[model samples]
Target: KHILRYVRGTTNMGLFFKRDGTRRIVGYSDSSHNIDIDDGRSTSGHIFYLGSSPITWASQKQPTVALSSCEAEFMAATEAAKQAIWLKELLKEIQSIEEKVILRIDNKSAIALTKNPVFHGRSKHILKKYHFIRECVENEQIEVEHVPGKEQKADILTKPLARIKFKK
Candidate 1:
């Protein structure tokens, strides 16, 4: 299978972490909207890194169906924010260091919704749980930022990629 080949081909590749001055916890959130043809649901993915090395990552199907790409991205960011909170608490307890948690999302609109408390026709129907990221941003627990699609590390977890792109 391709997975087996990939693993074999990358036998020498691995994540390497080094002691750095910055103790920032950076996260990337991404979603593939309407990827599930069965129910039109979306896939959510998140990856967190301590300094420049990845610490944790997750990819799962979303529970609810998102009506728009923005909604899907918002839900994904919410999932990532929950993990960020847990990581923040764990780091605080274990290392006694409060690091800056920044979650990068490629969707700018979703980032805006988190920063601004706004409701309209498009976002009114979204579940209240998806709004949790807004609270996270307001409390300064984590920052939701904008990242370009090509630089979105979580993209690999959300959707399938071509052979060339996958190698990258």
Candidate 2:
């Protein structure tokens, strides 16, 4: 089976956390727009890292349908921003995190929406709850950065990928 082969080939693979690795929290968020036929909802996912090692991650179906891929990605980023704020607060208990957490998103439109208040005609339909990410960005809690789709590691969590792409 494919799973057995995968397990056999990665017996020695593991995440190594360095003692002196950067303490900053970085996150990658992604979504598969309108993937669920039953409800017409999208799937959202995010992965967080401390230095180079993954610290936390999530993948789940979105509660509502998104009219566009941009909207779906924006919602995903909003979820990640919430998690980032929590992580920042938890880390504050031990040490100070002076820099805003960087949340890498693959969609340029979503990043623009978070940074700019001006909304497009199509974007007007998106719910208000998803707009919280914009507040987070403005408050210095998180920064949304555009990452090319090919480099988005959170893609694996949003949907199934081909073997070649999954390896990336």
Candidate 3:
């Protein structure tokens, strides 16, 4: 099987965590819009890293159908934001994490929606729960920033990628 072959090829490879590295938590969130043909729902994906090593990740179908790509991505970011908050709290018990968690997203519109409180007609249909990320941003708990699509690590979890691209 292709998965078996790939696993065999990287049997010795693994994530390395540096003791002297930064303790900040960084997250990458992405989505595949309208990926589910049966219901036209999207797939949300996210990866959280402590320093350069990945600590947590997720890939799951959105519960609600998204009408637009921006909506799908916003929902994905919201999911990641929730995870980031949990991680922040966990880390606090060990050692204080003073810096705000950085959540990287590939969609510009989604980033804008989180940073701006203004309600737009296009986003009026989004569920109220998904707007929790905006409150986190307002409280200085998480900071959402733009990441280029090609550099979004969460893409690997959302959909299949070429072997060469996946290696990156």
Candidate 4:
């Protein structure tokens, strides 16, 4: 099948884990507006790295339609935080490191939501499960930082853009 052929051709592509300390373990997450006209669901994407090389990445549709951009980004960060915790556990078992995992998201509103515990009317509609990111932050398992939208690489998987625009 064409899909199989494509997979075979891209077998060389993947995350490269390095023992060198030149890189830092960090993650990036992004999401698109609800653009699936039929379903109204947004896409979620995340990528992790050990320094400059990638260690894990994924792209998938959100389970439900996001009521706003902040919601979509929050979902993406939740997924990324889960992966970050898993990766940290894996690294501890196989190697020794004393650094906390860091996650980068472009949505300032989402970042604010995670930092603030006051569940007001705006955030009341978010599903309960997605609040796990806050717990993870409190436990020091993961830290979410704000990155500018133009610098978010996870944008590649969550939406379509022109070649020139994407490269930027």
- Indicate which candidate wins on lDDT: 3
Rank candidates, lDDT, best first.
Answer: 3, 1, 2, 4
Which residue pairs in candidate 3 collide? none
Candidate 4 lDDT over residue span 1-168, tens digit each: 999996897687654555666445799999997978999999999988887877788999999889999999998899888888888888878777568888999999999887877798999999999998999888887888999988898888898877776545
Q: Write the per-residue lDDT of candidate 2 for residues 44-107, one digit (tens) a residue.
A: 9999997887889999999988988999999999999999999988988888777789999999
Query: How does model 2 score by TM-score?
Result: 0.90
Over 4 Å off, model 1: 1-3
Best by TM-score: 3
Candidate with the larger lDDT of 3 and 4: 3
Decoy 1 TM-score against native: 0.92
What lDDT would each prediction earn against the true structure? 0.91, 0.91, 0.94, 0.86
The count of backbone overlaps in candidate 2 is 0
lDDT of 1 by residue, 1-168 (tens): 999997899998777888786678999999999999999999999999988888899999999999999999999999999999999898888776565689999999899888988787889999998899999999988888899999999999999987777767
RMSD of each: 1.6, 1.9, 1.4, 3.0
> In what order do the candidates fall by TM-score, top score first?
3, 1, 2, 4
TM-score of each: 0.92, 0.90, 0.94, 0.86
